[model samples]
Target: MAAKRDKRGLSQYRNEYLAAIAATFSLLATVAAAGWSSPAIPALKQDDSPVPITANQGSWIVSILSIGSLFGPIITGLAVDRYGPKRTLLLSVIPLAIGWVIIVFASNVHIIYAARFLHGISYGTAYSVTPIYLGEISSNAIRGSTGVLITVMAKFAFLLEYSIGPYVDFRSLAWISLTFPVIFFILFFWMPESPYYLLAHNRDKEALSTLRWLRRSDESSEQIEKEFTQMKALVQKTQHDESSLNNLFARSNRKSLGIILLLSCGMQLTGINAILGYAQTIFSKLEMELNAAELSIILASVQLIAVFIPTFFVDRAGRRPLLLLSTGGSLFALIACSVYFTFDAFDYPTETLSWVPFVSTLGFIVSFALGLATVPFAILSEIFPKSIKANANAVFAMVTSLVVFVVVKLFQVISDSAGTYVSFWIFSGCTACTGVLIHFFIPETRGKSFEEIQEIMTVESSSKEKTKCLPLLC
Candidate 1:
């Protein structure tokens, strides 16, 4: 009986796990669009190139997606509040499919540009709304695990692009990618609307029913009702308080926004987007025996594997330690890459040191995947009050898109003018500054309920005690 009970307890989360997978599944295509340049750019620049592109055109192709993404969050923020995550996400698929169709038939650079912009819109909408949806649907007991799925799926998508794009022609690759969004829509259409959204709209009965379906199996009526009551009360309180743009500056919300922006900027400024977007081009500079495509696949695989570490341990080991450790490790890797580039820049013999850039990049990916990639995103869903959460995500997504655009657009120019060594050194300095900010400002939210996390944000910083290490970090 004891063993049977334990098995039943584990089975209760089956629907939650399935819904999270289906919702995030379309990320495979949108994210693949981001990294598609790694392989496609090289092909486009070839003498036999189907649709010839100059280096400047290639950079635009990569960066324009970010600019297009700026509109996505704005739409999602407005629509999610009025409509609901399920419907909003389903509607997002329209732009995504249209983008791919354009790409498949694209004959000119301008056509590809328009397609990428549409892809960016879909990417932004999915990212902006998915985290909020997952947070609302999941029980606090498993929220951390569910939240990390966003990054996990993203890394897997990057791997898919790196592995597949190299072997296929551009149009063929686009055709292959188009299938993912369809798969996501088919799987996710049947999934339930978020219970929190229902509660907020005063549809208490529907909210309760959805919660029961999500929590299926031997869960007692009283337990489900108790949970439903708590959710309703929290939603009611937040509705009464009612967040607005003006109140977004209230002490707690301002701090949360600051922390999110800092992490977002840090994640981009550290050059992850630039590196991934131009992985093949960056590796080509080394003149290695192995091709750039193989190296990119390896790097993406490392990132995919490293992301799983935080997925398992984030709720258990906590967020702060992993973040600090990831930052420290990334700093060390950036310094290593910078040193290699510096030697190469000075015309030193680097043939024997050919392995350095590849290895350092792998190290950076591993460290980045451990925390920077996953933690800040998870924190985005946790930190804000429910009233302001959608607005906050819009702000976060828009700012992040802007920062990524700047970094990716300039990386090629910076590398050409100042050399790769200069870019890596700048990244290291940014990483160091971000580490300092994170240490002092970012809070640990592991295992906490949304209410508890909000309470933590409300307290004055001066009033709380300092510790030698954040909880579990020591």
Candidate 2:
């Protein structure tokens, strides 16, 4: 009887873990497309390249993916709400596979541009959908672990691309990267739809059934029924609330949106994309003895290792502490890079400090993967009510893409004009300021259920109002 009562045990998470891993394959494909430019651009600029591209064209190839990111959210926002996350995610695979096919047969830079634009669309869609899907299916007990997989899978994909892209021809790399989307579609097609999505659509019976499967419990199980009842009530409440852009940004949700935007900006402006996009380029400029490709592999390997740290401790340590440590660590790493570049700019003897750039960069990647890379997405999945969750995610994802575009586009210009030290200084300042803001503003969501998290956001918003009134009262 005691064993029968243990329906919510760890064994219940087996299916949820499986489903989350399947969703990550889509993310793998998306990140591979984003990082492909890192390796493929160098090959394209080679004198004997098949599709010769100027440096200007190469930059467009990388940054235009962010342009595609801009439009992907709109499609995902519409499709995800109507068709549900599973189907919407399946549909996203079309553009990704098509994009890779175009790349495989590309005859010119313009064709590659179109292919990359499609890749960006998939990038935006995957980021918007995967977290929401994982969050909806997972119990609060393992939600952080599942949600952090998004970053872990993305880092793995980046590592895979950097490891493989340098050795293969551009077309061969395209052929290899295309397999991820195909595998995602195959694996994810059979997974159950989110119980929340099913309930929202008035498929309560199916919702109950999916909940049972996800929890590995029976229809007659008391714990499963109780859990299903709570989920149904939350879904019913959110489904009745009108969803619109105005409603999403209204006072009730304004705080969540603000937090998401801050996290998104901090994640991008601290130089993740710029570094990943230009790692080899930066290393080559320093005349590193290890060669650019070897250094890039090392950088990516470090990222793969660092990103795994969150999956183990996110739930145990909580989001706020990891995030605080991440920003603080990143602040120091960026300052180190800025200081080194400052010394180099002054033509000081830096022969002994050749390792600073690589070491600082590795430090930045580790700090980023530990929290900034993972926690934001986990918080994203927790904070929003179901009524506007998809809309909020789409908005957050779109803003993330736009910011990445600006950073990637300007990194080269800034480094060329004012020197790389200035770029690092700018990033360091941004990280410091963002960290302070996050410390004061962003609330922790570890171990919080969707309903509990909504209540916390509402309370926080109300407290903000009361604090504002206290000043006037005094």
Candidate 3:
């Protein structure tokens, strides 16, 4: 009887996080989409490549995918709000699969451009939908884990490209990349729509069923009903709330918006895009002994290993602490890289110190992959009310897309004109300043309920009630 009861408990839908897992497969696919070029660029430059491309043309090809994604958030935001997360996610798969097919048959840069833009659309939809769906489906206990798992899958995708892309033909890589989305569609088809979305649409019966399915074993029907009622009430309340771009200009919303933009911009400003785009050139310039491909694979492997560190700490250590650590370490690493480049520029006898670039990059990746990469996202979801999230996310996505383009395009221009050290110095300063920004502006969200977090963000404490200055968090 005890064994039977345990078996029943284990079989409850709430006990399983299969839906979240399936949803993340789409994220996995997006990572593959983002990572595809890292290996393919070299292949395209080779004389034997099916379609040879120049560096100037290649920059557009690389950055244009981001350009496609620039419009994705608004489109994806509307789709999720209207059609719901599951169906919206399903929409993402079609474009990704089609993009791969286009890539497989590409004889020129134009076809590859078309394919990458399609992939960017898929990526944008996943970014908009997956976190929202995952947050809705998860128990509070599992939310941090799910977020960390996302980081893991993203790094895994990069590793997948590094590990496999070099050895395979471009057509073969397209075929392999194509399989991820097909697999995602198959796995996610059985998953239900987010219960919150169902309730907002007045599908109360469906929401209740999903709620019941998501909360089982120790949770009674009464408990499920109560939770469902609360969700319904929140959804209804938020429905009447304004989410205009004008709302983003309000004092409270501005603070939130500021944090969002800083996180988004800081993500790019820390120089990860530049590093990934020119890892070979950067390493080669430093006179590293290892082959470019070998160094890249090693660095990618290190990043894959390091990104998992957040999953263990996000809930326990809190968000701000990790962000501080990540940014602080990044500052130190960036400074180290800058010093190495400074030394190299003057033709210093640095044979013994050729490892500095490699070491600093590894440090930056490990630091970045941990709290800096995932915590902003986890906290971003928690900080906003359901009412403003859609608009806020669209803005966040646009800012992210715009910054990636500027920084990536500028990285090359800056390196050629001034020197790589100038960029690294700028990155070091940004990381240091972002760490300070997190200290003053960001809140610690761990151990707080969503309602509590909202209260922390919007409600000024009595100690400051008479003060005229509006603070981010009291």
Candidate 4:
């Protein structure tokens, strides 16, 4: 059974709505700062007439950012658990701002690489910390939507950079990116820390205060207290173990870890990043006549439109069904592209083959926005126990960055050597495998409470028998 919800009046819901908007804005600021730098990297590489930086060298610079981001989650997870989200977020802005400054002034490929690595750390920390903060502060009824809001905001950031990066100089784009971090630093000072974190650390009075501020009424006091007690109990249950990191892989946690890791990995294998990162090159190979700027605008518009589909239906339609639909849709799109490419390999006319790749790419993007892009973090946030949520999230982020790095790098080599059709086929195979895994292993989490989710995951039962377990803690 789902946990009972706190009854807030319409006025209170309004306040919560305002707070969610504020949190979304904060997230957008950080994401814009991190993502804007990426679109500029390709441009910087091609700025050879002015100054030479090979495309491969530019890619290396971008890859280093992912490497640096791999560390952000681990470091910020500990900090967020200890000092709270507000402070950790405040600290994150410094590196983001500095990294942009470095990128703006960088004279050579090596300097760009160093700048990206530094920015990666900021990106990593922000990704983990912001979601944790949002999850903690948001009402359960709106939690999934709140998580999607972050994804939506990040997509907007990506779109923003893609649309504008081509028009402006790389240095100017880097400067524009700096504005987000500056505003984040300024506004984050007023934002509240996660009340859940306070309770975890035994700061009960402060936790109550935060609840009051966030909830804006005494009506939820009982519910807030109940939640605090539950969090405290969970923390105590898990506190005795000194090995915080390894606890994620402990026997009891294995299923939870498995679900998170597989889902995280599946997210990358959907090939959304591969599509977005290489959209222009893919279009060029298809014999499309559009320039870089025109292609980027089209790509960005498609992504932006696709994001709205999930935003509207994610809550009502449920996670598992949407995931299945997304996987199947993406597979169809990829296979179509593969078939078209195969036809081209046999000397199909350019006029015939040109539109095939274009339509295939659009279908792939739409499918991804519907499925992999929307649900990975949503599922992750619900699956893990609060005690290990941060650490597990860090691990998830690290794995995602690693996969993206490998996929992006591999896509480049394979697309260059083997051709576009082979690349699409590879991604198609991955999506098919992910669909099979989801069908057999992934649980339906929509409309379920965190505690209900824990019980469902921990209990073992016969395939034909439904298991009814108590909430794991509280």
Candidate 5:
């Protein structure tokens, strides 16, 4: 009986793990879609008519998708909270598939923009909802690892697209991206609703049944019951004062929300997306001049390699240190790139100037993948209480998407007017400041329970409040 119980527990967890991995296919799809056109330089230029897309216009087309993504989190949050992740996830895929179809057949810039916007919505919701679902279902022991695993998969998808994009037509890349949601939609229908969601709606029997399925055995009723009891207690204690958009800025919750939002904003300001979006151009400025396919492969491969740095250290080094290190490293790389550009602008020898920017670009990718890329979602998932996790995640996704949109657009404009070197310097400055802010404000959150993390944030906020309230004499 004891041996059987252990085996059952392992089996249940395996099923849950498989579901988690399947859910991440949405992320993979998002990456593949986002990067599909990035490596198709010849096609992009060839497709242009009498009035070609300027650098800025090209960036705008790419950046406009973020505009759509900005609203996805908020909308999906409400949907997920009301209907549960199962329905929300299933529905989210429709927009992604539709967006791909549009991109695959797009003839005009306007059509591409429309398709991108739709894709943005799907991307935003998936980014927000996946974590909420993962966190709700995962045991605390593996939550952080599971969250990072999704990111790793996302990076791999990006790399895969980059590697293959050059060899195929842009339309084919869109078709490949469509495969994920199709698979996810089919497989996900059979997966269980989040146990937390079931309990939230007072569906005890159903929650238990789902737990049994997740655990892969009908045994361990007592343990499962205990877990449910604890969940019930937590829900009862916190449900009355649960967070909503209106109360997100409430006195008790505002500090945590601020931390999460700032951290998210910091992630974007690190220039990861801006660089990735313009990787081909950046390489050109560096004097490397890789063909579109080669550039894509390099960028994707770097992104894939860099993610491992965080994966190995996140659980060991804690969040704040890794964030600080990555940000600082990125700042250094940006400064190096800027210096190289400054030289090039002044007519420095081509051979010397070229390699400087190339080296710096590699450093920037390393820094980004090591820290900023993996941490934002992980931190967001941890900071919010269960009651507000969905809304908070939505809010985070919206803000991140909006910031990415602005940054991508701004980088393009600056690159067009001021040159790539000057543009990167600005990014460097932002990253340097981000490092400082993270060091001072963000808390370390490795190995802590959800309740413990909440307590830490709560106590820190309370202490700050009291310090502000103290009189001059006291």
Candidate 6:
């Protein structure tokens, strides 16, 4: 009986993990939509390409996703009201699937751009709702690890695009990308909606069912009942529409929103999207002996490795320290890249240091993956109150997409006007300033429960609410 009970416990854990992973397929689909341009750009720019685009046009193609994504999160957030997180996430796959199929037969650049934007809507929804779903379902003990899966899956998708995209025809690649979402919807069909969502809707029994399904069999029934009761009480206590713009600055949640938004802005300013979208353009500008496509693959591989580091450390080391480390390291790496470009721009005899730019870029990606790329997404779902959580995510996702649009467009314009050197200097400045801001403003969220995080935020908000000017930020 003891052995049978132990086996049952293991089976329960496996089932929970499988369900969580299935939900995360939405993330994989989001990334596949985002990363298509990385490899496709090079393929399109090839001499015998079917649709030849200028560098500026290529920038537009990559940035167009931002256009559609600006509206995606809010839509998904609203859909969560009627459909719940699982259905909202399931609905996200339809757009992605449709977009990929459009790409498969796209002959015109405009068609590709429209298809990208259409699909990008799902990317926005995935980032917004996926984190919330994962946060609600995940145990605090493993929240950091599970939350980081969004970033991990995204990087994995980026790598997949780079690896297979370069070698395959456009239609073939599109068909391949379409397959993941189909698989995702099939596997994710059985995963329950977020219990928190069920409880908020007053479906207590279903919430309890989901909670039990997500918990280990070895967990005491009393403990499970206690959790269910707490979820019910909290939902009843705090029930209200928290989506108003005024509530965005409400004394309680303002600080959490402020910090996460800054971090989100910083995430965009760090040039990750620019680097990924224009991997070929950036590599081609370098004085490397290898092909741009090969260099892009190398960078993607390094990025995939970099993205995995935070999963192990995020819960253990805490959020602020890693953000400090990542931003500080990225600051220096961006500066180093600036140095390389500056030297190359000046026509200096720098033949011996051709490797510096690639190495520095690789370093930036490593540091960025360690924290900046992963933490804000994790922190946002943790820090924000459940009342306004969906809208805050919507606004944040919208702003991120907007910032990414400006950054990508500016990258091409700046690289065309002054050079890559100036662009790196600007990005490094953003990193340096963001590092300082994080040090004084960002809170430590490791090992804290939702209630604990809220308590900290409430106290901090009340204390700091009096000051009209933020000392650290100002």
lDDT of each: 0.86, 0.88, 0.78, 0.73, 0.75, 0.83
For candidate 4, report its TM-score: 0.89
**Candidate 6: TM-score?**
0.94
**Distance (Å) between predicted and true CA of 408, model 4?**
0.8
| CA displacement after TM-score superposition, residue 41 of candidate 3 (Å) | 1.2
Better of 1 and 3 by lDDT: 1
Q: Which rank order by TM-score, best down to worst?
A: 2, 1, 6, 3, 5, 4
All candidates in order of lDDT, best leading: 2, 1, 6, 3, 5, 4
Tell me the number of clashing residue pairs for each predicted model: 0, 0, 0, 1, 1, 0
Tens-place lDDT digits, model 4, residues 1-474? 123343434356565555555555555655664455346656665636244676576556545667888988988777977888778877876777888898788787677777778787887888777777777786666666667776777777777777878788888888888887777677667777777787777887887787777777674578767766776676676566444887787756677777777778888876667667665556656566776557767777887789778866776788888888988988898899888887786676667567777777778778888867777767777777777888888988899889878877777777768876787788889989989887777778777877788887674645443332222210
Off by over 4 Å in 1: 1-9, 217-219, 459-474
Model 1: per-residue lDDT, tens digit, 375-428?
Answer: 887788888888888888888889899999998888888888999899899899
lDDT of 6 at 323: 93
Worst 10 residues of 5 by lDDT: 465-474
- Each candidate: RMSD to true structure? 3.2, 3.0, 3.2, 4.6, 3.9, 2.9
lDDT of 3 by residue, 372-446 (tens): 888877776666777777667777778888887787777777888898888888888888888887777777888
User: Which digits, one per residue and each the tens of the lDDT, describe model 5 over residues 236-305?
Assistant: 6667875667766665566677777777788888677877776666665554555645765776787778
Give Cα distance to truth, residue 162, candidate 3, Å.
0.8
Q: Put down candidate 2 lDDT per residue, 1-474, tens digits, no spaces.
A: 778656656567889999999987789989999889888989999999999998778878989999998888898878888999999998887888999999999999999999999999999999999988999999899999999999988988989999999999999999999999998999999999998889888899999999888888876899898899899888878877878877886767777888888899989999889889988878876756788988999999999999989998999999999999999999999999999899999999888898998899999999999899999999999998888888989998999999999998888778888898988899999999989878877788888778778877763435556664222111
TM-score of each: 0.95, 0.95, 0.91, 0.89, 0.90, 0.94
Candidate 2 vs candidate 4: the TM-score winner is 2
Better candidate by TM-score, 1 or 6: 1
After superposing candidate 5, which stretches have Cα over 4 Å from the reference? 1-13, 47-52, 212-218, 221-223, 289-292, 459-474
Better of 1 and 3 by TM-score: 1
Model 3 scores a C-alpha lDDT of 0.78
Best-fitting candidate, measured by lDDT?
2
